[model samples]
Target: MPGALPYWRLSGFYFCYFALLGATAPFLALYFDYLEFSPARIGELIAITMLMRCVAPNVWGWLGDYTGRRLAIVRFGAVCTLISFAGIFISKSYAWLALVMALHAFFWHAVLPQFEVITLAHLREQAAKYSQIRLWGSIGFIVAVVGLGQLFEHLSLAAYPLAIVLIMAAICISSFWVPDAQPRHRPEFAGQGRFIEQLKRPQILGFYLSVSLMQLSNGPYYTFLSVHLEALGYARGAIGGFWALGVLAEIVLFMFMAQLLARFSLRRVLLASFLITAVRWVLLGNLADHVVVLIIAQLMHAATFGSFHAASIHFVQRSFGDRQQGQGQALYAALAGVGGALGALYSGYSWSTLGSSWTFTLASVAVLAGAAVIATCLKEERP
Candidate 1:
């Protein structure tokens, strides 16, 4: 809506940032497996990376909010992430890798929540346009997943760390190009009380609990979906295509999200996403051997991640005051991290013993529980 909006600059940062995710989320576990690490070890390493999100965002968020320097924090975090992640090139030992994951992720996780605050500040009154900017992240993800899949087909999995480092460098560079914007304080929301007090509200607690559960459900998919498909006799390139397909669907969802939100309440959208995600996990668990079933499951990522994420961002923006925006987004990231860590830990331990089918079924159960929370606690509200 604003003529001076730095749309491409904002979108570029998201592109580079999520491009790194595209490489890591689908392939990181496979890289660990290439090192001959056990399933539990791979899970532990991934969990270590995720666990940092629980702390990193909140710390950086506070500093950004207190200092009024959100962009500076984003830039600093990006550089630190790139520097720390380079440690992966030094050692392949489990201890070394775990330390590397934790250090890099601590800084890496710090970037997004603060950047989210920045993005929304830039959008100002045209908040509905948020999805248009965010869709580039999905495109970036698609590019990385498909490109790296083909690259890994020709190159060694050892190339994974290098790919991530280059992408981090891009994220660091992109951060500088986007100018910062401050959230406009709204007097009407001032009476909403302290941030901690708001957090205690049933709806807020329920929303966060549901966020954790949704991510917890995603743990298996992110941690092992590539490995699982590889075991099912699919080629690495095809596996990448499957991941890309899901993001492609996510991109499509983002394109229409402004209109979608206009017609439906956030509660209805979120509840539907949770329910569809439940069925998706079930299909992936039981019938992944069927290409058609696998395709359908992957497509559900539109709901599982795309819609859920867009809705969650809108919710945070609406719920918090100008001063609390960074923290609101930080807490959202932190809770998702908590759920993700639990999911990764449990799925890793269960993957070999309980079998893939059962592991995903467990994921399905977690999502259904999230759905129940949404159905009962979140009220119907237009975004």
Candidate 2:
């Protein structure tokens, strides 16, 4: 199409990637509950899945950058994910489920960072269109969460595997139609730069560390927020609504994000996001009972996730340019992957033993630390 990518051409793939996440994030705990798995067992299963992202994304990134064949790696990863997810359907045991979870996550996580590189490539000078493209994925998430919430209330938990399989199949089919554009390497950004050199840049290191801590803080939300909300007498529909609200806010943020960034420096945006995250978690910890406060906290997803993510990607694109895009994207995924894994594991333990308030309070502290690092290290000048 003229300026917009034909949704028929690209939206389906984004839909598949995010739709799988929607199913897993909101309902995985409930799925574990149905299998009679204990809280700890569920935590461990989810932690292992996050752990796989740490290694898999980097591995896939390396292969893609080295071969200059990003799409091939994505296609392979998707097929592997499908095969592994099938293993979950065949077995009901915790051991089998854990293996399935880890295996599928390894492959599933590999696809996204590469897809990000692909999206950036396609965006060219019109990166502002990212939200319009990405919003469809948010729509997919809303559809999965709302539709499946009602479905699960009536249907048995046995439907989980079938739902997952069908969504994954959609992803695979969509992958076939995704346009793969190769980024032209820019020597200025590439020459004499080892990965370690890139890592050693003060702004780069600071940005990575700051985002790592912020994501670490998010561990509790990704792992236990749904369970916590459910415990507070929020029905599945309400919880789904709450989750949908956050994404809706995120969609709004994405829509205005280009203008926001043009008006604000990246460091300023990152700084604000970190501070808002600190407040959002603290509120989520102490004020979830107050509907008004909860809605406000949910709205902060715009700053905490959508703004921060756009700023990070913008920083990467500005800093690394075309030549190092793959590696830059991989490094972001690596830090986030590792941080998220540890955060999920720790949050699982803390949520069960220390309780939600203390867990989220600690999460708030983590974000504050990230904010401090960014304030000190991320700079106005690109290296």
Candidate 3:
């Protein structure tokens, strides 16, 4: 399989990973809703998962980097994820659910940044092919979300956790088949700077702040957009369709992102993503009642998420060089993880008390603040 097309092989793994998320992301809250978990309990559960994202990846990345054993770490993590997720099958109470989400997320989040290290190692010569590789994740997400959406329309929501377990098993199996690739060491920066100094550079700082804000704004959408849509009378299938549409737009953007990055500065691409995100959120908050407007807002996800993420990864590669790749990716995961966790926790409170519109409006405000910080403080020096 290593001789297979790179995109198909790499993306097949991601398809499994995110297919698991697609099953969980769209309907986990809804399942909890069925179980009559209080809004606060639901928020805590999701927030804890994101919180684990904040803590686990750093420790795991450091281990991978220190030992130079990234693939081994990834495989170990997959095994742990498979075992930990089974915890959910036996327990349904809020406290038990929190423990399960925390454990699974610790291992699940541990794998991606390291996988990213491996992906970049393989694609160093033809980085433009990232979208071709990554688009399968969108495809996987669509399959799981759409398939399970219809399933839930007819079957019991109790089956949702099992759906995630099955998909994760596929992820672990695919992961085992993924070829092990190690990043080439950069001799030029072999001993150049401290991790703190690399982090303080203008362009890197700006990109991190910008994306942290972007993911922060996504808090409300990831946490409650489905609930909000359901409240507005959007059927489950239509809601999944809307979610899938955002990723489809993401697929289109990924198709051409390599060219876009080659032609434009990462700073420019990053800035455009931030502006569009601000627009997307505000539109979602105020115009969600209008289907056409909402669809337009969703389409902007191509730029808001796809372009932003591609550019952010590029900036990290440029900013940190080979030596700090682990740290760079970990920092991205950390800041975004903490921000996303806060966003989910806060939005849960906001969603329950203040309402969805106000909650999303606040998220847009966070984006605006992030954009301002990037504009004022982030300076890009040509390499």
Candidate 4:
């Protein structure tokens, strides 16, 4: 049965795609710094990517659901992403960089949510295998963060654009390896508006709000922790290792995700993630140069991203059926974009105007609010 699944193909796509994230996420802000951009400007640039996600995924998801050509959409998104990102190498001005970021991200963000529809369609019966395939993404991230960190130490970061381009190429090649999903049609679908109904549920609304805030809270970590640590005098390799440690913990958690899900309620897992995320922001903000504190906070990624994301994925899968899957995932991604874009914008402004300690303390408070919302509003969840 495992052999029958398109395991390697699915895994390879994740590997290549996340490797692209690895190429950019930890280093891009630093690259902005290298170009002498201000904190607010950098945040705006980062926000451009998330801002595109707010629109692109929905447009693509609707196309996939109506046409049943999710893989074709994935391939098209990937190719366009490559074409748009190539502009990065040609431009260095603030306006040029911002334009490219928006263009490529619109296409890049469109791919993953629909691909989620495809992967879940393939794993229709054995969805738990998702963590197994997804772990390779963590592995890819770890490899890129760690290897690129070392490489940048020896060479100027001028090499960064080329690395991203190559990863984009790999993602394009991997797209051809998987087949499209054939969703089982239902007669009740004629009534329409099923997704809108699902969104109206109080608990569902709370879940999306909480998750959006969680990502909003993460804007600093994803967009600025490397720059923050570097400002405090950490070596590039050390910073990369710090990022890798978090994902390594995430990988270990993925390996046992099924067992964790079996024993714990989804609310419990999500609550823990929210609580721990609050703690991580606090530590990162207060003790940047403290290696021991940093390590402890890094370990918390298992809960912040790992457990929280796994639990959210299961919730989405449980909530939406085959016919509605694409839109459902696209909605999930879209909300995250809304939150991330806002977070990045505010965090960027706050980082320069308010200082690191206050900025992250604010992030911690936001996570606390999310936890409280979950505790009170998310009562229906048992899994």
Report, for all candidates in order, the number of backbone clashes: 0, 0, 0, 0
Q: Per-residue lDDT tens digits of candidate 3, residues 73-111? A: 888888899899899878788888888999999998898
Any residue pairs clashing in model 2, and if so which?
Answer: none
The lowest-lDDT stretch of 10 consecutive residues in candidate 4 is 183-192
Off by over 4 Å in 3: 1-5, 380-383
TM-score of each: 0.99, 0.95, 0.95, 0.96
Give the lowest summed-lDDT range of ten residues in model 1: 374-383
The C-alpha stretches of model 4 lying farther than 4 A from their native spots are: 184-193
Instruction: Please give, for residues 269-339, the per-residue lDDT of candidate 2 as tens digits.
Output: 99999999999999998889888898999899888788898888878877775656777887787788777
Q: Taking the tens digit of each residue's C-alpha lDDT, what string does model 4 give over 107-168?
A: 99989999988888888778776888889999999999999999999988888888889999
Candidate 1 lDDT by residue in tens digits, 4-24: 999999999999999999999
lDDT of 2 at 240: 79
Model 4: per-residue Cα lDDT at residue 260: 88
Model 2, residue 250: C-alpha shift (Å): 0.3
Candidate 1, position 17, lDDT: 94
Clash pairs of candidate 4? none
Please tell me which predicted candidate would have the highest TM-score against the true structure: 1
